[model samples]
Target: MGLFSRRRDPESPAEPFQFTVDKVFVVPVRGVVCTGTVTSGTVRVGQAAKITLEDQSRSVTVSRIEAQGKKRSSAAAGEQAGLFLGGLTMADIPTIPGNDGSIKDGDALSGASVVSVF
Candidate 1:
């Protein structure tokens, strides 16, 4: 092995899952759904995560996942998916501190990143 090519430790913790939001949807009774592409690691149904937008954050659970209009149990890096954020409604999503409106339109959530919580 070369000096710069150290072997990965099998016992090491997995990388934290991350997904970048491309859009946001607020379903009347099913909770908020964020559609985007997974940038790293993997996320599964029931997984806990934190959504960070600017300086605001929210803890949520991955209640469900879908891709290509089909239901999915998990999503991995490079895949696009819609993640249902369980327990959150439109009222729970935060807006910029001084902004005048809540994140109602999908465009407001663009570029937000969701990271898995240990």
Candidate 2:
């Protein structure tokens, strides 16, 4: 292949949908939103996804996807985006235990993961 030529691997399979959550916040009208980068594959609005947080996991419906402050129907790998999850509230997130064994009363989804897309 030449220096400027692109190589294609026909034997390689496509990647599955995956995202690493960086932050989670609740909006008054939009409910819970998870903001992160889509690491692989694609995610679309209205698709069902599985979110994993530490040892916990929950199924949620994708209500909206936003990138660069604009709403989009779908998001692909390498895009920094936010996914609005339906039927999720701040109360549903698991609280981290403090050093004293008390539940921390702040943002509980800082390190969550969108493990699967369905």
Candidate 3:
């Protein structure tokens, strides 16, 4: 037997992997809908929401806008799971009128459609 060899530790810590969402949130729904507060009245149809590793961005349509109820669920960062966003091209991030220079996560948390996964 080689005495120079030593036993290796069988236990190893799991990876410190943290997932960051892209600048768009998409969900597979039967129909198209939009919901959110007009934090920026300057928003229009065909816009993109920029999400980064620091925060989340969501894509949305202007015309699909609707009022959200409290019964609906909210959107949060890294919350899109068990869904497939296929073949859906996200529009450009629309400009909000009174933007405070902060990225919007598309209030899925407030039942907003800002977090569209395409």
Best by lDDT: 1
For candidate 2, report its TM-score.
0.71
Error of 1 at 64 (Å): 0.4
Candidate with best TM-score: 1
lDDT tens per residue, model 1, 44-87: 88888999866778888999999999998788899999999875
Native-to-model Cα distance after best TM-score fit, residue 97 in candidate 2, in Å: 11
Off by over 4 Å in 1: 1-15, 93-103
lDDT of 2 at 104: 36
lDDT of 2 by residue, 8-109 (tens): 756333335787788787778778888999988887887777887567678888899999999997788899999998867677766677787655334567
Q: Would you list the rank order by lDDT, best first? A: 1, 2, 3
Candidate lDDT (C-alpha), each: 0.84, 0.77, 0.31
Off by over 4 Å in 2: 1-15, 94-107
Per-model C-alpha RMSD: 9.9, 9.2, 17.4
Ranking by TM-score: 1, 2, 3
- Once fitted onto the true fold, the runs of candidate 3 whose alpha carbons sit more than 4 angstroms away are 1-32, 51-55, 58-108, 111-118
Put down candidate 3 lDDT per residue, 1-118, tens digits, no spaces. Answer: 4889888766342212112222334434623233333332222223233222225543333233222332221232333321122223333333234568544344323332333223
